[model samples]
Target: MSDRAEKQTGGLAAVAGAAKQAPGRGLPPVHLWHPEHCGDIDIIIRADGVWMHEGSPIGRAELVRLFSTVLRKDPDGYHLVTPVEKLKIKVEDLPFRAVTLERDDGRLRFTTDVGDTVEAGADHPIVVETDPVTGEPAPRLHVRGDLWARIVRSLFYELVETATVEGGRLVVRSDGEFFALGPVGAGVE
Candidate 1:
């Protein structure tokens, strides 16, 4: 392999090893690591939440989940970080997809494709942006430290079903915070 490719392969193994060595059952403390940038890897997180490495889909779900635990977002880009090395990756959109949602006692909890569960509230607020050209609403929930999950179409539909009209907008309440889905009567077209 070329030098750069070899470095990337070695870096991937290092990162996977570091992630597996995480002390407990929770995610690695990637936020606290200030490792030197090891350069970019040919990993791409597609808009649909598929993790691709070297042009093929990363077929191992467990490996993807493990890698997700070490992901960190910096001002420059998204990275997989270890205490010793940090390598950037490309994200076509948000890094995760909110695949399922549940409501309990007025609070909303969402599960991402990578197995992250986050409750929507002040800290993990939900936001919607309208496409300038299509005017369709794109909703997302903050997952963690600069990472957000695109709320999937089905979950967005569920949110709409539970939304109430407030101030001419359709809004849903989760953990005492209200999030606007869209303006009332806004067509999806």
Candidate 2:
């Protein structure tokens, strides 16, 4: 197929079609996250109409279409998580890193500057949290500083930390007896 005539179909559509007919490269679930040295990133791409993570079950038809985009062109339609409109990260740990990723099977490949190459189940869930909620019109998120990556990271950490905590004083102690320390005016004789 020549470029001139191939332009008739949209670039993505054309590629998706081609991949459907090609052999298997073993489509892996694309994982995106921030690096440990940097901030946290817990974002989910809802715009793609489909929410499939690493190891997610997909019919061959869907896999072909997705692979076509990756095989044909750069990752533009890939689903990535973010906080509201900006990337989120904790401010206290400013000037850090954001590890974004894309994965398949149990293997993962780093897509950004901050992260590591490791194996993670494809079904790993990223809890999407929003302050203003998804409805109405308010931006559904929170972040530190003005960086989009910061926002993304912060939101991710916040979600994970909160989920791990059962009651919620802050830290999730493994065994310590959480004794109440005296305050400034508690009067400890």
Candidate 3:
């Protein structure tokens, strides 16, 4: 490997080791870490939520989770911040994908690809937007802080299955809150 490649690997390894030592009590305080910008890394989160590094898929789920812990979205763009360095990463769409969902009582719980679980409620609301050009539905859920997870196609279908019309809007109730999926005429009425 080149010297730069080696440095990147060593830096990532150090971060992973530190993450392993820390208690698995929620996400790390990445917002507080003001490390020096180390420029952009060859990391890309594809639209489908696959994490790619150096034009290859990052095969280790643990590493991805570790990286996700440090992810931050600044006014400029998305970045992965460690104590020592902050590396920018590209995201074609949202950084996470809510691949699995479970209905808990009147609430809905979502599990992201990176293993973060979020419940839809006041703190975490589900929002659906229509693509102005393509007219396709783009559904997303707030995971934590400013991070969000895009609801996958299958999970969105499941959510639609339980949808109801309220106030002329297609809506679903989760966490005792009613979330409008779309207008009643969007085929959900």
Candidate 4:
């Protein structure tokens, strides 16, 4: 149809082939890479546009729509990273509520400020007895869900990313490089 579409459908295969052609984003330690990047899947770093079947970017609006849709459709999956591996949390840090994880071109960040911090009440134990003369357990933490991690990892999602709508181009990036998601539909809003 359009030049963008042609590139999206055809040359994108070569672009997808460049999956091995990893760019030097100089990413921080926190921005995690996806576990799988095989047939029909090209996961780019700090990229722009939508994720396509050919495993390439499908332009801007398309990418935004798909990302929003995936988020709305699979709210849980949109926040956490994929390839769910068991992580070690503290028992003393349990009995909390929500969590927030942010990803930038920099690193794979984790934040667990779910709810307001309440004073340690009688309902919860002040300290966890490990051996004999130990102290309190410590501050609590919660890992984000799977879908969220996938969305974050796949698109390099960030919470405070500045999105500027100029002349129809959506200049969206975290820290710097442009990014987007795939398998898109209409814009959510």
Best by TM-score: 1
**Highest lDDT scorer:** 1
Worst 10 residues of 1 by lDDT: 180-189
TM-score of each: 0.95, 0.24, 0.92, 0.18
* Total clashing pairs in model 1: 0
lDDT of each: 0.91, 0.26, 0.85, 0.27
Q: After superposition, how far is residue 71 of candidate 3 from its true place, in Å?
A: 0.9
Candidate 1 at residue 24, lDDT?
Answer: 66
Off by over 4 Å in 4: 1-148, 152-162, 166-171, 181-185
Better of 1 and 2 by lDDT: 1
lDDT of 3 at 107: 87
Candidate 4: worst-modelled 10 consecutive residues by lDDT: 84-93
Q: What lDDT does model 1 reach?
A: 0.91
Predict model 3's lDDT versus the native.
0.85
Tens digits of per-residue lDDT for model 4, 16-123: 233323334421111243432212222232211123333444365433222222111122112111222111111121222223444445432343222222222222
